[model samples]
Target: MRSSISDRLSKMDKRLLNVRFKKSTASIFVLFIIFIIVFFFHPFNELTTVNLQSYPNLVDSLKGNTVISDIKIKKCFYYSSCQLNKVEQLQWRRLDSPLELYAAKPFRSLSRSMDIFNTFVFVKQASAQTVDSALVDVKITLKGEPINDSNEGWVSTDYDSYTIWKKFISKSHETFEQVDLVRDLDILFGMDDLQDSREYWQYQRTSIPVNAPVLPHLTLLKVPLTSHNKIFTEFHEFQSLKQNEVLLAKSNSLKIVQISDLHIGPDTGFCLDSSIDCTADLKSLEFLESSFEGESSSKPIDLVVITGDLIDSHRTKEFKSSILKSLSPILSKKIPFIFTFGEMDEVPLYEDKPEDENSPDESDLKVDTILKLNILNFISSLPYCYNKFVRYNQNLHGLTNYNMKVFKMPVNEETQLKLDEPAAIITVLDSENHKIDSSQINFLYRENQPLKSKDPFKLLFFHYPLPNYRPQGEFKLIGAYNDKKPLKKKTDMKFRDDIASLGYQVVSVGHEYKNDLCLLSEKIDRNTVINSMWLCYSSGAGASVGTSVDYDRKLRVFQIDFEKKQMLSWKRSALKGAFDHQMIHEY
Candidate 1:
């Protein structure tokens, strides 16, 4: 009876085990079904089902479908007799959209007829049909224009055309109408009733009459409205010395280009002393570009120095644009550059007003200070400009007074570990007031106190010639001396002696437009030549400024060999080209 009972219990246990195995198998099958559903049928798995071959087309469809095929500017004389003349047709790059608009030719009012004119901007746009449908009634509006239900499909850009137009008009006395439409097309009436200022009209009577009608200097921009597009307002493509201080120390030799007296104005510049009718600003830019192109491959330019007179302060209403235009070549090449202030640079905007208004009031003073600060901020903000990094001493008489050091390049990784010393030092002083005061002298003495032991090659740069700077003296002269009245203020001999005592080898300046001489003078002490310094001058590069018509616009090039401790300079003429009047100095 015990054996029979045990057999029945065993049979029950087997049945229970079989039932548990079947239940576990059914649960596993349910989980597999869920996995299959998630892997192939779930909404999140749709990405995997898309064909890889169509990915590029899918991306293209998502991008901006509108394309700006062409942009043109048309000038007209009257509203009734609208004879459109295509003044400019910009060839824009497919990758780079334009950020600013500039006039290649100045818009002048008809002097003889005295008829005011208007300008029209035409933009040819093309659009691709989207997957949903065609872009229906696509419209575009300039920046700062009002957007409402009437212009529901209008696309807006990042630029503010209205503000830019106002800024441009502030520089001139010509009255302008608000930006309006000429027709119900892709045409914009940029400037309306554009008349010349009374000052310009009087000047035109004395000078040769310009036959063109008055047109506005409006800012034009062609940019994509897509969210992914980047707006390039500054020189972001170029590398700056401030970001890469090692750029100067990496090479044993350096080539520096010195351009001066740009005299850039708000409008396309007028010919000052030129015989032929030409655009001065455009010509000046061409000269600058030629100078850069004249540089040899073996001796490429690394630094540029503009010794003041960057803008025509008399017409400084559009100084920001003028400054940008003047520095285009340097900015384009991404070369490091420095500049000093000329007397014109310091002229207050209110100084041109009437006698009572000429004396700056409190508000005028504030405005002047703000303008100066804005200019300084703008210049310093440029990627390749070094003017902002200049150290200022309150005790000094002028702004932009500082010193820079160029260190010797390391031979290898091991040599770079050693204590680095400056191979050369450059000191820039402000002689804008036409004299170097005792405070600047004291500042120079104090700054050089620590560097006395190292005895590096010291070079000084300023705007005006020194008090003792004689064109023809016991010194050697290398270039032209056409300035009948050399701009030199009276200062004590102590300043000259201090420069020699401080071990300054080269003292360069730029003020006289026709003077391009490099005078080498020796400091004699008791019949012994104690020290020698090169007093050099850079000629005016702007055609708008007063210069000898016979003398072509030129740039001064200085090549410094750190290893040899020598500097070689020469002139690069606009008409005659480069390699003229070469001069050298060994320290």
Candidate 2:
């Protein structure tokens, strides 16, 4: 009986031990699972720094009451001369970091800091899970103002704050990439300090550590402007008709936005709002807006080429002002644009003012010539227009004729622009009288001389389109001017051939006011290799005969791959109509 009782007691004790063992195993499994969740979801690993400890005290301080400390903000203006220090030490404390403290250089400065704007903070990730494994959450405040969407004091929390805040995401183990914050800042306030409260300009960035229990908690690190250096760097200013070159991006693509025939004047729809049917100015403005909007969404407009006829027949000062005002909304974006003259821009020679007391006979006193020169000067003053060529090429009948070379810019600070092979040659030719004179052709040939051996991608811009030789669209050869005075041979049909022989892959023209893209296939070296020369016409933008007929205004955007010596794609963006757009042609 004693033995039986002992056995039963032993069995009960063993059962209790088994229950405890099972519970312990379950607890260990739960802890392991929790640790794994923290390891994968929460990335609280120490960041490695050069000339500094692998583990920073900021991580420990994150556990305490203090949010963050030991951060310095460096400020510098990015004018033509500012140099950005790209050292490894300057790469820390990104806005997305749990305890971020850094200053951003200004983007572009217009005359010192008048129109200066620097993206202050680009916090991609605001949360700890978004930051590091140990970090739970982080809050950003610019100038003692919280950036949360609930705050209506400093930021516009109504519509875009949430979206902008959500765009901040963890880019890598060390940094968070902020995409839309800069744009949000631009929208909320004006681009620079002057737009927002000027008083807050001094206070740049502040970070608040929200969670982490070990070190000082809620420690705030205010990164002030420690230093601002005004350093000058070498930059090439826009020179005269002698080749103003631009760098071709790594993609080997060149995008040209053609806005043609904006016949803005007092008579157009802008000044005639009372007449709803005569809303040409309004319609023209809408078309420009559409074209620009499309460009902003798609690839950036590398070069905006205005193919003549910017003004109407009524060349009054008021009309010119009205025209400038009408175009201000688009050109104000500061896009790089070049100009060519059209037939309508001409004021008949009879309308010229009396000659000056000592005006030379060689000096052109024709109203048309004077008007063209005055208009050229006016556009040259504009921020976007690049007509420096007029300053030097005063001998040409049409001062607009010149050439610009596009050079490939280096990939980084260490690399320099490649001057050996020009990426592309833009030949701005003069065809104001629907004719290309031998002198003009010779000028073009001279421009093409230096680039002859390089075999660079060539693009020709003028105001007239090649004559449609096909039977279906048989049209008079209008690309050249014919002398009304009796001459043995009148036709300038060889103009197209001359351009083709010079190896121009594309010819862009306006005047026609029609959106047309066609290939001029010609045999090269009389071999099997056929060169398909692209001829494109940008649709009329303003009130003109073409705009009146059919009323489908558009901007033609050409995307060319210079490396391949072929146009990758071409599309016409309609200003108005049921169809958004149709692909005109593609390579």
lDDT, candidate 1, 417-489, per-residue tens: 2223556666777774577778788988877776533657667887777866663445677888776564455
- Residue 558 shift from truth in candidate 2, angstroms: 1.0
When summed lDDT is taken over every stretch of 10 residues in candidate 1, the lowest stretch is: 199-208
Evaluate model 2: give its lDDT. Answer: 0.47
TM-score, per-candidate, Cα-based:
0.58, 0.50
lDDT per prediction?
0.55, 0.47
Off by over 4 Å in 1: 1-250, 273-276, 348-366, 389-393, 410-420, 452-455, 471-473, 484-490, 548-551, 580-584
In terms of lDDT, model 1 sits at 0.55
Specify the highest-lDDT model's number.
1
Task: Record all residue pairs in model 1 with backbone atoms less than 3 Å apart, i.e. clashing.
Answer: 109-214
Candidate 1: give its CA RMSD in angstroms. 26.5
The 10 consecutive residues of candidate 2 with the worst lDDT sum are: 186-195
What value does the lDDT take at residue 159 in candidate 1?
Answer: 34
Which candidate achieves the best TM-score against the true structure?
A: 1
Model 2 agreement with the true structure over 176-294: per-residue lDDT tens digits:
22121111111111001101111111212231221211111122222111111110010113222124445344345677777778776543333333445465656776677776767
